[model samples]
Target: MWSDYLSAGFFKAFEASSGIKVNFTGIDSNEEIINKMKASKGRGIDICSPTNMRSPQWKNLELLQPFDYSKISTIKNANPAMLRVGHDEWNFGAKGSHWLPMIWGTEGIAWRTDQWAPPRAGDIPSYGDIWQSDVKGKTMMRVHSGMLGAGLYLETIGKLEPGAMKKAYDGEPGMRKTWQVVTDFCIANKKQVKLFWNDADSQKNGLLNDGVVVGQTWDGPPISMMNNDDPVQYRAPVEGALAWIDGMALSKQAENLDAVYEFLTYCYTPEVGGRSIDGGKDDSWGGKGHGYNSAVLGADQYASDDYGKTFGSVYPYKSLANLWPWPKEPQWYADVRTEYVNKFNAA
Candidate 1:
């Protein structure tokens, strides 16, 4: 089972071809999925999808089995650049094996273009827009693994030194003050946030139905709103978008192993992946780059025209340089961020 945000539904074509009834489970955040894996002891779940940022935590816990590239024939079609960006395989595992990139995207402010404009503003949206005095009681944000909010808060206070962020995730010296700044900002502006969301529907509802003018959000909700004729836009804030990749991983002890492996490779198929996003366009014109791309072969052919105009995609799939994924660290930073969130939620 996997998160619904990865794809609208499991690929029926794969099921049709393999005669395997693909079972899927959906959740909003990586932390929730991690908790599920822990509670279940990763039993019965043949395969699962998790944001690549969580890969470090998963691998450290030995929660996932080594993905044998020697056997998964379909891996030949995957993006070569993404083969193994992290992990010290030789010492870490038999070969330091782990998950693969399923889909990639960024987190940013989803604004109602009709409701607010940039301060200096023709069109480019900035992360600071969410903190303006006029927007009080009408903004929202998300707790996507703790980093997205950290990025925004750090940028807001001018403490976004790259090395400082790495230290922040690592819980090093001086990072505590930075973390305190963020936590204090959170307490101060708790009332400014109309809501904090974790799933797609909450964000979609917060923006579309609940009168939220500007909120920290993922790319999907704003695009879904646009498709429904809502004037909305998702963009990389001036501080930059928080980029991360999501992909599938096999549990160490899974039933139906053969079917699980088949489903893993089947998902990378271009027709299946491309069609799943952007309402089945399966073409370059799919709804504005979607901020994600397949890790498999022929993914380059699906780049978006709207996003390509701004280099969101190239001949091959890629994320913008300004987009930052999670900082590499041994400890899962969500443990820290969730502490802050719990207090805020209690308020």
Candidate 2:
């Protein structure tokens, strides 16, 4: 849905203005990007999106090349904090950034408003809510992330050590110790999950058709549905939304350098960024948008009114300050985490 939305909305406009057609492919996870690029050594893919934390692993793999910043003049329109992440972390050899921030959002709770409400009427839901017997056999989540949320919930209730999830980044021993506890807890309650979503479409289907009363999901998909009058709402949980920045990376063996820079330049424009979030009843490019925040400055001004309202509802009480920013993952951490995920899925 993200690929199609961007292709139909801003990518189409970029084509009209620059005369360069984009061949877009929607990918579900960072592993997919890594595998596809590794198979070809980045030969066929010109630009690919990887979340910010995944940059270190991709950098270690030699799958990406540093961007020539001079060519992307419109980059000045990007949010300074987001740009700093690229410069500080993705600066391969400190020569230049290999990644540029594109879209930013959080993974949190989305529930069927008609079927379930938070335990407290006005309070934000907690990650622990998904485990309660009330919603058993009526929930959905992704394997890896749902376990992370379970760890967070355990932390909140004193079941696991404080900061257990974040400490998983410290080393393999600590990660295994912490994740084992989380895995046990999840396996014990695995019956609660009716579906495990891998992408936005699966998430939408789980909520609207698979009888999911509540689920962990990205902010974009459910918000898109809510705007269309689906009986659903997405909000940051009390443990904080797991935040990440999706980045545009240049392939090491990119064949279309000019087109790559053109696409980045086009994306960094404020109007393009804003419209990507909400197309504002524009029939030419579909009436809706991706339903997430843009990293470009002044992009909000051009977004539809629904964007403002939805933003308020989702981030009420300045919960943006409560976001749990994802820490960079080493290759070892990612590998071990995958093992735990596989175990949970099999159990």
- The top-ranked prediction according to TM-score is 2
Per-prediction count of colliding residue pairs? 1, 0
C-alpha TM-score for every candidate: 0.84, 0.97
In Å, residue 188's CA in model 2 sits off its true spot by 0.6
Each model's lDDT comes to 0.63, 0.87
Could you tell me which residue pairs clash in candidate 2? none
User: Over the stretch 251-336, how does candidate 1's per-residue lDDT look in tens digits?
Assistant: 87788878877776776776555544543443333332233445666754543334343333121132366666666544536566
Candidate 1 yields a Cα-based lDDT of: 0.63
**Alpha-carbon runs more than 4 Å astray in model 2:** 1-7, 281-284
The best candidate in terms of lDDT: 2
